[model samples]
Target: MPTVSDFIIERIREWGVTRVFGFPGDGIGAFDGALGRAERHDGGLEYIRPTHEEICALMATAHAKFTGEVGVCIATSSPGAFHLLNGLYDAQMDNQPVVAIVGQQGLASVGTFNQQESNLERVFADVAAYVQTITTPEQAEAVIDIAFRTAIARHQPTVVILPHDVQAMDAVTPGAEHWVSRSSVAAASAAITPPTEAIAHAAEIINAGEKVTFLVGAGATGATDEVLEAARLAGAGIITALRGKDVVPSDIPYHTQQLGLLGSLPSLHQIKRCDTIVLLGTNYPYGEFLPATGQARGIQVDIIPEHLGVRYPTELNLWGDVKATLTALIPLLRAKEDLGWQEKIAEEMRGWEREMLAQTEVTFETGANPRKVIHELNQRLPENAIVTADAGTTADWFGHHIRLRRGMRGDLSGRLATMLAAMPYAVAAKFAYSDRTVVCTIGDGAFQMLGMNELITVKKYLDRWENGRFIVVVMHNDDLAQVSWEMRTEDGNPLWEGSQDVQSVDYAGWAELLGFRGIRLHDDASVGAAMDEAFAHDGVTLIDAYVSKNVPPLPPHITVEYAKNTAKALLRGDPSELAVIRDSAAALVTEQVERVKGALHLGGRDDDGPR
Candidate 1:
């Protein structure tokens, strides 16, 4: 009685997908027909068309991360699938669960070089946990079911490509049944492995050492509580990379500091003082800061076996889930009763937090310090506001300054650090969780890369007058300073660092043209006023803050060695090593300038407009 399209929609319902994010084309014409029928039947599934396929995939990833459900995204044929690859790679690296359904050219076009022909299976092979092409209508239903389960079970992304001709064929009866509800679903605890005797032995090594440290990475996502428990028991100092900041707040008592190129002074100090280092769930790429082979015996633990010993030499490697391993080891390890060392570290952490907070105060009289604006935004935001951050300096700043409330969630480009994911993600976040406000903080450089195409989707949805959606806040500094700094040299040679002049582009005016209620803030005094106007406006709004071009964010986790080496590379004038050093120095310089400028500009310039 029903066509193949109806059967596919039924399967999607079974997978608990109520909304779909995608771009439709002729290859996916059957999806449109099916959507029309499903809407008439009150299926609750609606299609949202984003600007690019990559954005569509990222939106789904954000939705899944926020809601703990399988987020669905669709695309049409080869071009669409190719675009989806970048976002899917990001999701894979971040370990987010998502389902991507791509429409392929008709069966007749197979091996015939059709207009949109593509080897989608190969395209997604490296990025996806599961990639399959559904050829027949019968196989389509079965493979779709498998795709959903694989994506959810593994907490990984899966791609299903179907030919338009397959959906047009009519043979099998539609019999896919949906699970309306289920109780007592299992948590992802199985993925975590129990810690072996190595952890206990490693704790003994800590007991022997006068100074010990704990460094958490992005892989420690759900194990924050467990990691904290272990740290407290061992009386070991704690630190994390920027990606792991959300794992443990900077306010924690024993928190030493973060490590890496962007690490803080406190973290660098602790790294140097510690006699033993216990690495947890982090494969940090910068190996220069790590202790040499004999100095610090590194004990690394991770659920994924292949990731262990990739970055630094490991004295001991334990393969297991971070939370489970920590839980098992906590009981076996004895607490260090002496709190003198930990107390000192805690004092430094508190002092650092206080100093950073005070830096924003100096800029308050000048009207919106970006940091202060972020803090205020964090306060006014709803308890469950979902923030999607774009790549570059905006991500670094947001990671450090945008204090996360107990229930709030934030999504970024993950380990791959792709650009232009925030806008579409905000759009999808709105559709997935209308109860929560969605905010996108993007750098001017990153926004210019992908914001225009996404605005069309925003205008389309706003014309329909949807309520309680998303808003974008652009830090318009008018320069690709982040990249330029990476290319710069310490010697100030034009041939070394190249050009820093960014073309003067008015992003806010462009947003206005794209049908968003756009506002260009000319002074710091207008941040709150502009925010008020933005929230009150009906559809989408863009608040463009004219920020300092040279101000780069200094994350609370940068190290001195990293900083010194950066200086050396610049001083040496070695084009090879200098290229690497320039990025770190430029980042530090940018942040230092902002700190110094904020002090100098006290009560001088507004936070808006070019000085």
Candidate 2:
């Protein structure tokens, strides 16, 4: 007779989950045994063991993000399950489909305060779209099926809590036939199409305006062609939220880069100038960057009805799948002939790209410019590279500088905005697509936080990765650079004494100790060679590139509040801070001059200059 654990594994395998990431403990011994039995079979789920439970959750989330498949993770009771919260929240906020299976203490110990006892359901409630605890063997299969279905359909995290005793019980065998066939599963969950009236209303709102801007978000991930077609039909300039950065290729003439704080000047200009804004599959949280309530008419298209008009006041809300809605609306849209506005925005983007290139060209006196390092990495990155960035200044440089090709995929902690996710994301990406190169750009502080220990996990899995390069680029500034910058520039305070500054560690040496190639690059001259070495290596590699902490993540447009704060900070700061600001100012001036020259076709070449 099959045990409850065996039934659960069978259901998961049938649902096409190839791998489960987590740590095993006493509470999950029965489930682990079932996993072992399955692995002996021909095509069974592989259990990936990460050193930390948090990383396990992160890996599962990234796996789903990259493959568009439901990612699964498991953890033991209490502390093990608690550790998965951070990564589970990443999946929840980012809207990735993931299912977390957490083991709980035996039912007998529920009220006795036994070891590792806690209410797993309550712990995961907020981070999951659905949470269920299986008390009996008969409930196991049903709950697992529902969890998987809910996670995939809603594109959110779901949790199934399995107590120790229940997992060990004998499952009530159903009729000899399969419990649920694949055909039944497919029929139960089908794509939703918007009503004709809703689609027509959205079309009317979009057609009414002379200048329309399409803001794509994560919801438009697989509907790139449809989005581009819609943009072309409306004669619109396309701008993506950070989560939707990979939705539209940067090389496309009509597409502007990401919008908001880490956005380009051209995108901000397009947003401000457009008479109408069409939001597709993206609930962009920043309303300040969007057109005001009465200034521009808004049309929002999303799968979830509740999210409609929640971000911006919309005249029409088309609730449906992005691709399906666009497919139906295309015939209704009158093809726009006026390319004048789009052309203007394209020119602005060209100028901004030139400015960015010039900034990347500027070298620091001591260490390598972080922008230059990112630019070089971008140049050499493979067309199909899976890039991940930590939340901080590293993500700032990545969002602005790293251009994604048509086949490339990348993401950061968009809504969660948590640190120490880059490395775990890379590991997950590599596991999902072993044939593709995986690169993670992380800040020094973030790397030290949780990424340092995860390196051993990478080392453990190095041999298992068949055909991919795993590279971790540490933006080493020896401090919490982003927080320090915020303190100085936003709060008008000098760098706090011991709180903001961190002692420098030999990260490359640490990488070497963990059985991976470690390379440290201090200047621009060695950057290319270091990158080449890291990419060419067969096993895992870490590049600890020392960068300047003084260079701020300056936005596309500088505001008056920022200027006043910067002025206050400079006045109150020491001589060193003054010198740093002076150097940065000089670099900015040079970058502006280059931008002007490029715009006028005077000096710099039009093409992306040599790496």
Candidate 3:
């Protein structure tokens, strides 16, 4: 008879899972043996082994984010299971579907102080939508089915603990008597659509507004045309959250890039001045950046009812598929004759674009400006590139730069806001879409934490990627840049050397050691040439750019409170205070100079300069 592990593997394949990320250990030796047999027989399943179990879990979440599929990860019991929590929680917070399978000490060993045995159900209680342990062969299929279904329906991670003995048992069918159940693979959930009345009410609110703005988030995926149609009818501008960067192409005239701390000036201007706002499938958490309560009449739409009307108070909340709901509402919205508001939005966006370009021209005495690095790289981004970023000033640069065409894909840990996930995310993106070019940016602090080892994993799979155009950019600043700035800006304190300062690593050299092309970038003049060389390479490459840590990631609209705190921080004797003031002054002056240049170029048929 075939072992239970064989049945489980077959069941997973039946569920349409083609890849699994994991690490090996004796606790999962039975399942590992089954995998070996499957491979021998050409089971069409691919197994990826990462340097650590944490990476396995992170890659699983990333796979789901990139492909919109249920990601699967496997690991051993005890310590391995413990390592999965960070990435599992990342999935839980970001609302991605992931399934984690872990091995356990045999069922008989439990409750006897057995080594490597603990109550896994309790351990996974907080992070999983569904957690189960198979006691017999008869229970395996039904439980596995439930785990997948629950993860998909809820967009959450689920767990399955397979004891050693249970894995070794022979596969058997459930009997007609005595608490036996059976299940088969099926669809996870039905698509949701709002009631006709709700859509009509939402349309009424938008029709009544004079100056309307739309906020789109990740939930707006596949609804780009509908969003554009609704905005065109209402004479509104569109603002995307960071997660929704690729939902709409950046070239659209009225599409304000992003809205939040890492947002553009036009996004802030439009949000502050608009008389009405429509929140479309975006759960943007920064409430302060949104219009004040009652400042604008609001309408919200989302597939998940729980996400509706939470970020901003809405006059109407419609629970439905974004594309379907927008399609329904589009017919009801009237085409506004006056294009004045959209024209103003377009003009402001032009000004912001010029001001942004001025920032990239800044240079420090010892380090290159990261803004310039990303700015040049953005000019060469492929239309179908898959981009990922870690949490830090890296995100600030990525959010402000890196404009994506419609077909391109990009994401980072949003709600979780975790560091060191960029490399794993890019690796998984390449695995899911091997033909697409994958580019990722990470800060030195995060790169040192886990990325050094993940490079080995990249080397192991270098020969497998169909396109082989993977590039990882590391910002080598020799400091915990984001946290150090946060201390100065948020806490009104100086940058403490004891905690914020860190040793820098030769990221490019490390990449070369792993048989990949590597470039060390420290000057602004070489950014464009370096990017061209890296992108043209056939295999993987790493760019280690030494960037200035003193360049502040300024908020789009600086408030009095923020300015006051920054002054206090500077007065507190920050070590990089002089560089901070110099860069800030130079950037502000340059932006003003560019704005003066943009004034004459706007409000006409002058498309003379690059947008």
Q: What is the TM-score (0 to 1) of candidate 3?
A: 0.96
Q: Put down candidate 3 lDDT per residue, 281-375, tens digits, no spaces.
A: 78889888999888899998887778888888788888887898888889999999998889988887878877888899988775999999989
Candidate that beats the other on lDDT, 1 or 3, i.e. the better one = 3
Cα error of candidate 3 at position 455, Å:
1.5
lDDT of 2 by residue, 1-611 (tens): 88999888888888888899979988887898888887886546888998889988998988898888888999999999999999999998888889999899999888688899987777888999999988876567668888888898888899998899998899864434555322223414435778888888888887777889999998888999999998888989999888788889878886888887778877887887789999999989988899877878998988877789888888888878898889999989988888887887787788778788888877677578898899889988887888999999988898789999888999988899899999888888888888889899999889988898888887777777887478899999887888877776688877765787667899999999987889999988888999999888877889999988777787877678877787777788633476567656867686668656755663443333311
lDDT of each: 0.69, 0.84, 0.88
| Highest-scoring model, TM-score | 3
Candidate whose lDDT is highest? 3
Model with the higher TM-score, candidate 1 or 2: 2
The residue ranges of model 2 lying beyond 4 angstroms of the native Cα positions read 174-190, 574-576, 594-611
Query: Which candidate model has the greater TM-score, 2 or 3?
Result: 3
RMSD of 3: 3.1
**Per-residue lDDT tens digits of candidate 1, residues 171-276?**
3643544722222223234465644667677667766766778888766778878888888777788887655666775457777445654455457657766777
